[model samples]
Target: MNSAVIRLTKCSSTKCLAMFQLSYHSQPKVALDEGISSHRVQVGPHRLHYLRAGHGPHTLLLIPGVLGFGWSNFKHQLLGFDRDLFTTIAFDPPGNGYSRPPEKTFPPLEVEAETVAQFMEALGVESASVLGYSSGGRTAMVLAALHQRLVKKLVLASTHAFILPDEYKYSRSLDCIEETWNEKEKNILYGVYGKENLPKLWRQFNDFNERILKEQRGNICLHLLKDIKCPTQLICGQKDPLTKVENSWLLHALIENSRIHVYPEGKHSNQIKYAEDFNMRVQDFLMADEELSGTNIREEDIKLAKANSF
Candidate 1:
């Protein structure tokens, strides 16, 4: 990995473009029970793949992990959220799954969040509830802190608000996933990561972990937790190896209006593994916060969000 891939963005973009995906990924398949559609939108110079389902009153964004795509990660929710209650949207972040890279990599965490906000703006969504699982939760935090007005509510599951130095080595160890993967899992990996590019992908993961633990350690916006005004819920599986349950508790204690949901037998991908429970809890929260109270996101704030380009 080069230094460029690890550098953060510092430009702010106020523009929006509806784009399309030029690539595809092996994603978990699940049929939408009702009106659902796929869409592509431009964020800066990249095109993002996302899913749209239902016509509920509230807008909810389901953000996936590093390798998790919009549809595959939230397959269970494609038709789970009733059309009369919520409009659910999920997206493949840059450098992940179906959203291929013209940039060849992802932007900084800050830039990623702003790009997501711009994606919503491009789609004419003024504000939305955000749910980020694992890495996506970190993005949700940045969105809440900097682009405060765009998030109506928040749900973070197995998120990384802070990463310790040791965590880098632990993250690097994840490359062995390919070694133990079953045929089905291997197929998924082949579809999303490609078989020929395994070595390159592993190197990229190592490089990313090094940069995260060394260059960007403890910078997952924990300091900005106080700035996030939307009602937040932090969740974690008790047995999670990557991110501990205590981290969620710490996040709960920091965010003024935040709460916590701990899963006794949950792991890093608990939300997806326990999709039914997670979705149920998410719906319950969103329903209760129907009139979600938060600082109004203004045009100026959205501009400020763009200014965070690395």
Candidate 2:
């Protein structure tokens, strides 16, 4: 489907606003498989873009990190999951990726969560397992809290409930993305955001972090964390520079039915760096018959699993 165009009609709900049209361009090179299909739908005031894969009883909703879209951040899960048993849907939040025209202002996380809930409603997804990576986790926390019934299971990867002063400082230091990001990372971002907008967006995101630090005391979804009642899994990278491993522990402590898994040498983007292991682990957790135990898994267990694999 070259030059694939998705026509999104305005939602017919009472709360929905006026109708708007959107033209979506699906790149041929990035189209991974026939099972994955890209689409756009009008959700309230925003035209949301998303990718859907598989057709099964179970559903997985993937929320990407800051400046991330559905395909770029979640290609692995979209392709790796068993299509016969589980369906995966990944979306671009308002003002990001193909969902735009409103432009991202970095609204409060609760508002973002509402948008997500609305998006799911528009798509007819009643409930699903949710995986939110990095900043997306903030929105996911609020979603699980505000719309509890919409989330069956929750996964937070390299994310934190709130930002620390040091984190804000680190964010400020990354204002010049060209200097802070290595070539490979920069290339990936450039492919998603383009050369002209990538740097500006990064700077704007840094400014947003600063505003949250000052106005909201860096609390994105800390107040809502305890309200999330779903079986939660927190994936942390031990060597992560963005979100410290301690943040995962904090999240585990706050969410009663939560557990943590640490990747010894993994970094912030370990979901991509360790895609196979990460995918298998998430699949196991999401597919588990019963709720997994809480707190961190033992180091010896991790070693034992690795040894058994070998």
Candidate 3:
């Protein structure tokens, strides 16, 4: 993959517009208050909506990716995990889905990550295992770095610590924006199979992309990556264009306890594409009864699981 000559024709032009409007506000699978439940909690100046599920000794938290909707993001992993083993929590970040929009400055990844900690405190949860995908990966990373005592394990999927390879400008380039816009958002839905793979879901995709573009600007929070000391796992889709597979490799190199896994031919939606494998790796990591004197979970395993049952 020549970082320079990346051809995103499939995601460029009107297709980018189509991808910008993707929405997951009321996904059928996100049934809160039962197997899954939604709640509103105060974080800083905003009221955030989060989903809760299962009830067990182990608590698991999931963070959505850039443009990621709550249920739409981790729905697949939720289906794979044995609910009896753990309790799971997923939330809509400020300005997305059922959560209130951020005031003045959009909730940066760092602030959102801190808010996640505050959210747990309000729920009487002392600690939990954290999983983050894409942009959510950054949030999980921030949690581990700042609130080390609260995170039992960390999983990062298709994630990056910093905008790396300065020469690799896909995301920073106008082409990236144009490419994402090409996909209509209305048809972009995420499920166990990944990104819904629908060609006409333009509005759904666009709305998501638009939100990330606006909110994520100057908000990536890369400075905290090296500070993370939790058990960590990293997963990457071999064919991911939005964030290169190399990003995973870079993360593994940076996070002290990190490990890496790459699925050949898997793209940005690989977590959903390979949901079973993702869940298995996560379960194994959480099952480890290691002393928490330090982060025992390795980095390579980060992306192995995204939304396992708590």
Candidate 4:
């Protein structure tokens, strides 16, 4: 498929204009349960679609990666977090999921971060504890660094501060969806972005990574890591091929008040594969009054976190 065809298939000018003009009245009501409700709001030029659950005092914002949407990436977190203690909001970034029309232009991470801040403001959220997965983590890092007061805490899962040479090569290899993704991965992506659009989106995402590598020297937010003052948690899978465990360790080293959790047998999609453990650890970190770092975490604390998860 040629670039022109892909661009047309993603979003036409007429459809894009209609989507933006009807933004206020086009929200469709979709509810998973009594607690989870789906909504859409206009954030500047983009219309953001999000899933909101719980009525707790604390707010948790979930940012998905690459071809990820709110429900596709954060099903476990949407259903598992204690409704009494936290209100979770998972959004589909512009051009992905239900938030479309503009298609993904792959702007700078700083621009994406600013859009996130605007999203929160549109939703009347003053501040939130943010959780970002994969590429979304890079955006989260930018958000925390540029808008420090808007983020209460931060979580980065299976992500990196900058793209490595190996990562760039791997991204290049993913141009062809059929050859790059496993059966399960294909099914998941197919469900979120239809079978026809999946390949195009994947290719576009790969191109975005390549641009970052060449133009920015793979730097997403490495220079801004030190500016992130919020208490942070870095979760990684030891066996992940994309963002390895070393990425998490490096993040922990750079972010002063940060801790690391490595899942032994987990892969790139560990958040979904190891949902129970991941949820517990994230909950524990967010709920803790004191900052949690590698130096302070203990065996009993782990047990306590597991106990309090439910």
Candidate-wise lDDT, in order: 0.70, 0.79, 0.63, 0.78
Positional deviation of residue 146's Cα in model 4 after best superposition, in angstroms: 0.2
Worst window of 10 by summed lDDT in candidate 2: 19-28
Q: How do the residues 1-310 of candidate 3 rate in per-residue lDDT, one tens digit apiece?
A: 1111111112344323211212233232223223555566777776777766677678888888755666678777665676889887887776555453431124555677778888888888899999888878877888899899999889888876544433134444433333554343333433211343322233344443456446653224445666888878778888777667756765665576766678898876666878998888888878886533323334453442211101
In candidate 3, position 131 carries an lDDT of 89
lDDT of 2: 0.79
Residues 1-310, model 4: lDDT tens digits: 1111111112344333211111211322223554677677889988678888899998999999977878778988998998999999999999776676666667888889999999999988999999999999999999999999999999999999867788777777877888778887687666545677778887887888877788887766778888999999889999887886666666776677888889899878777999988989999999998965555455564453333221
User: Mind giving the per-residue lDDT tens digits that candidate 1 earns over 1-310?
Assistant: 2111111122333332222323343333333333667767877776777788888889999898766677667777765777788998888887776566532354577888888888898889999999998878888999999999899899988986766555556666666666654576556656666776644665575676566666765556667877889888777899886777656656665666776778898877776688888878888888784443332333553343333212
TM-score of 1: 0.79
Q: Considering summed lDDT, which 10 consecutive residues are worst modelled in model 3?
A: 1-10
Quick one: how many clashes does candidate 4 have? 0
TM-score of every model versus the real structure:
0.79, 0.84, 0.68, 0.83
For every candidate structure, what is the RMSD over all alpha carbons to the true structure, in angstroms? 11.1, 9.3, 12.6, 9.7
Off by over 4 Å in 3: 1-34, 101-107, 165-169, 172-185, 188-223, 290-310
Better of 3 and 4 by lDDT: 4
Query: In model 1, which runs have C-alpha deviations exceeding 4 angstroms?
Result: 1-34, 290-310
Q: Report residue 227 deviation for candidate 2 (angstroms).
A: 0.6
lDDT of 2 by residue, 1-310 (tens): 2332544344555544323223333222343465677788889877788888899899999999998878778888888888887899999999777676555668878788999999999989899999999999988989999899999999999999767777667767877778888887677666555677788888888888888778887666667766899999899899877787766766776677888889999888878888999999898999897865555655553443333221
Q: What lDDT score goes with residue 179 in model 3?
A: 53
